[model samples]
Target: MAHTPFKSVGMVGLGKMGGAMAKALVSQGTKVFAFDPNLKETSVEGVTLVSTLETLASEAGIIVIAVKPNLVEPVLAEFQKPAIFVSIAAGISYSQLVAKTPQGSTCVRVMPNLPLVANRGAMGYFCEDQAVAHVERLFYGLGDSFRVTKESLMDAVTGLSGSGPAYVLTFLQAMAEGGLQEGLSYEESLGLAMETIEGTLVYFRQLRRKDQNLHPMEVRNWVTSPGGTTIHGLDALERGGFSTAVRDAIRRATERSKELGKG
Candidate 1:
C-alpha cells in the first residue's frame, strides 16, 4: 500500500524556503513541526515550532530537509527510521542520505526554485524505489513534479528549472528598466513586463494544446514583421549574442551542479 497522507512535517531550517514550505504544508492540512536555530518568528496555528532538530525529527512521519547542501549529511545522521525523507538541497544525492540515515530508509532529492513558495514551483525529484510514492504524494502539493529516471540528469534539471527563475527574473528586470527608460513609469513598466511574460506563457501553452511543436524562432517569426521594431530588437539581440550567452550560462550551471553533486 502507498503512504496515503503525511500526518506531520518537520522542517529543520525556518529561513525563507523552509518558512514558505511550512506555510504550504499547513495550507494542505499537514501539521508542520518547524525548527530553526536562528528563528525570529513565533508559531502559526497549524505549525508547531520546535526548538531542536532531534525533537522535530522524532515527531515527524515525513521530514522535508530544506537546509543547505553542506548540512544534509549531518542532519541525516540524526534522522530515525519509519519516515520518508525528502530533501530540497541543491547538490545532495539520495545515495548519501540512504547511507547516512538508517539502511532501507526512504529518500527523495528534489530541486525547487523560489517560485514554489507561491505553489507555482517547477521542481524535479528523483527517488529510490522505496520512497518514490511517498515523495510524490508529499510534493504534489508544491507544484509540477518530474520524476527523473537517472540521478545524473538532476544537474541538467537544476540548470534548466532550478536556476531558471533567476534568469527569467533578471530578464524581466532588464525589460522593465528599458521600458522605464522609454518614459513609462516604474510601476507601469514592471506591470507591462510581468503581463508580457505571463501572456507569452499562455500563448505557448495554447500552441502546445494545438499539437504544435512551436520553436522559439518560429514564434519570433510569427511576431516579427518585415523591418519592424520587433525585428530590429531581435537583430540587436542576435548581434549581442543573447542566445549564445544563455546557452553558455546553462552549460556552466550544469557543470557546477555536477561538481556540487560530487562534493
Candidate 2:
C-alpha cells in the first residue's frame, strides 16, 4: 500500500567511505552494486562489484557519487542513464553536480563523515524537493539525517559536522597528553582520555532529559570550582584563547569546503 525507496543502490567508488557505505547497506539486507576503476575485479560479500560506472547506474535506481571532490564532474559525465545522482563528495555542491550531469537530472548533495562507516555518523543533505524525501530514506540507516532548506547552509554544515571529528580527536589527544603530564602511563592516559570524553557525552545525554535550560557554558561554570585544579586548566585554556581558536578553525574549513565546490 505504501511506496518504498530504492531496492538496489549503486556506488561509484570503492574507496574507504564508499566501500564502507556499501557494506552497511548490504548488512541492512539491501542490494548494493559498486564500481571502482582501479580494481581489476573484486567483491565485497553481499555486494555486487562492477568495473564501469555505466554498469553501476544500470543496476540501481539510486546512484551515489562517492569519489574524490575533483573526480565528481568527470565521473558524472560518464553516466548515460538517468538514475538519481547523490553526491557525497565533500565540496561538490548540488548545483555543480546537476550542471555536470544529463539534462533533467535529479541530484542531491550529501555530506557524511567517517563515523558513517560505523553507521553512527551524522549526515547533512540538501536537494531539490523532488529528491529530498528519497534521499532521506536512503540515508535513514546511515545515521542522524538532517535536511538543509537552503543550499548555502551546506557550507556551515561542512564547517561544523564535516570537520567536527578532527576537532574531537584533537581534543582527545590534548586530554591524553594532560593525563600523561599528570603521571599516568601512556596507555592509561589514552584510556582515561577516551573514557572521559565518553562520559562527557553520556552526561550531556542525561542532561537533555531535563529541561535543557542550562547551556554548555553554564555547565562549564558549574564544574570549574573557584581556585580548583579544573579552574587552573580552564584558566590556561582561556588565556590561550582555545575557544577562539576552534571558531577560527571552523571558519577556515567552511571557506575551504566552499572553494572545493567551485573547483
Candidate 3:
C-alpha cells in the first residue's frame, strides 16, 4: 500500500541527531513534537515539547526512538499503545524494536549519519514491509535513504555510510596538511583540498549518470604520467600503509557494530 507523506512526527530525545532531524522535519512544514526529561522547556523552535513519553507516543502516529540504545527498552516500556517506531539508536535491531513495542506497531531500524542535520545525509534503513514508507515520509526532508533487504546488513551500512563522513573529514584534513608541507598557507590549502574533492565528486556523478562505473584506477591512470608527481604521491601513500589503514578502519567498525547489535 502506498502511503502519503505524514503531516506530523515525534521524537523521544532531543540530542544532537534527534534535534537535527527535528529541525529538518520542521523545515519541511511537518508538525514536530519532542519529549526529553532533561529539557525543562522547549529548546528547539517550531517543535512542541511534551512532558511525558506516553503523551508523545499516543499523539504521534509515527514516533522516532531517538534515545540511546540503553534507553530504548525503558522508553518502550512506557509506551503501551501501538505506533510506528523509527529507531535511530545505533545497534538497536529490528527484532529488538518489534519485541519491545506493542503488537500491531511498525518498526524500522535506520542508520543515519551526522550530516542529516544539514539535510544532505546518506541514510540506510531496514524493515520487513511497507512500514519503511513511514520512514521515507519522515525522512523526506532530511536526506537520501538506502533500504537494506536484511536487518543484519544494517551493520555493514553502519560501518560504511554511517561512519564514512568522519573518515572523509580526516582524509580532507590530511590532504590539507600535505599541501602545508609544500609551503601553501593553511587557509589556501584547505580551500583547494575542498574544491578538488568536490570537483572529483562531480565528475564521478557525471559518469554515474551515463551508467559508467566509477573505476577510480582508470581516473588515477588518466592523471598519472611516467615518473610523475602523482605516482610519487601514490607511492608515498602506499608506503605509509594508508590503504591498509582505511580497510582496517572499516573492518574494525563493522565488528564493533556486530557486537553492539548483539546487546
Candidate 4:
C-alpha cells in the first residue's frame, strides 16, 4: 500500500465538487467527515456526514474547504482548529486563505473542474512549500494533480482548465447540431460527436509527450487538406469567430478570478 499523509479528512462543504471529491477520497480508503449547511451531498456511502462543523473538525486533522468563493470566509471562521487546509474555492487567493485560517497554518488554493466527478479531471494548486506533498496526496487518486510555481498563475489555471470542460461541451453541442442539420437524428449525431471528441483526445494525448512531437496546428493541418471538407469546416468556424469567442471566454474567466482574489 502507498503512504498517505492523512487517512481522515474533514470536508467543509459537500456541493458538486465537494461531494465528488468525498466519494473519490473514500474510494481511495480515506475516511471523510463531511459537513454541509444544507445537509446535501451527504448521501455518499462511505462519507460520515456530520451535523456541525465543530463535529467535523474534532475528528479530522486535515480539512478541505470546498465551499464557494463568497462562502469561504464564514466557513473558514468556523474551523477553529489548526489543520492543513485544501481550499477549492474559485477566485480565492492564497493570502486570503492563510488570512482566514489560524496563524502559521498551511493552505493549498486549488482550482478543480467539474470533470472530477468522473475522476478524470485537472487539479491545479498553489501551496505553502511544506504542504506540497501533503496537498498532492489529498488529490492523488482523484485526478491529474499538479502544483504551480507561483500563486498568480493559479488564475490562469482557473481560467483555462477550470472552465475548459464547459467550452468542450459547447463545441460538442454545436457538432451535434451540425449533424442534425445534415439530416442525422440528434441522438445519433451527438453520440458520434462524443466518440469523435473522445477519440481525438486519446490520439492527441498519445503523441503530446513524444520527444519530437509537432505543434497542435501541425496535427490539425495534417487532418485538413487544400479545399477539402475538413478545411471548409475549419473556414466556417473561423468566419464564425469560433477562436475569438473561445479566447474571450478564457480571458473573461481569468479577469473574474483576479477580481475575486482582490477581496
Which candidate's TM-score is highest?
4
lDDT string, candidate 3, 141-162, tens digits: 6779999998878888888888
State the lDDT of candidate 1 residue by residue for 65-92, as single tens digits. Answer: 8888999898888765656778888878
The per-prediction tally of clashing pairs is 0, 0, 0, 0
Off by over 4 Å in 3: 1-4
Every candidate's lDDT: 0.82, 0.84, 0.86, 0.88
Candidate with more favorable, higher lDDT: 1 or 2 = 2
lDDT winner between candidates 1 and 4? 4
Give the residue spans of candidate 1 off by over 4 A. 1-5, 43-45
Give the per-residue lDDT digits (tens) of candidate 2, residues 140-232: 677888899998888888898989999999999998898898899879999988998889888877887795675777777888898898999
TM-score, candidate 3, is 0.94
For model 4, the run of ten residues with the poorest summed lDDT? 207-216
Per-residue error at 17 for model 2, in Å?
Answer: 1.2
Tens-place lDDT digits, model 4, residues 27-144: 8889999988788555788999888988987899888998879999888887787888889988888888888998767888999999999998898999878998887788877779
Please give the distance, in angstroms, between residue 144's alpha carbon in candidate 4 and its true position after superposition: 0.7
TM-score of each: 0.91, 0.93, 0.94, 0.95
lDDT of 2: 0.84
Off by over 4 Å in 2: 1-5, 41-43
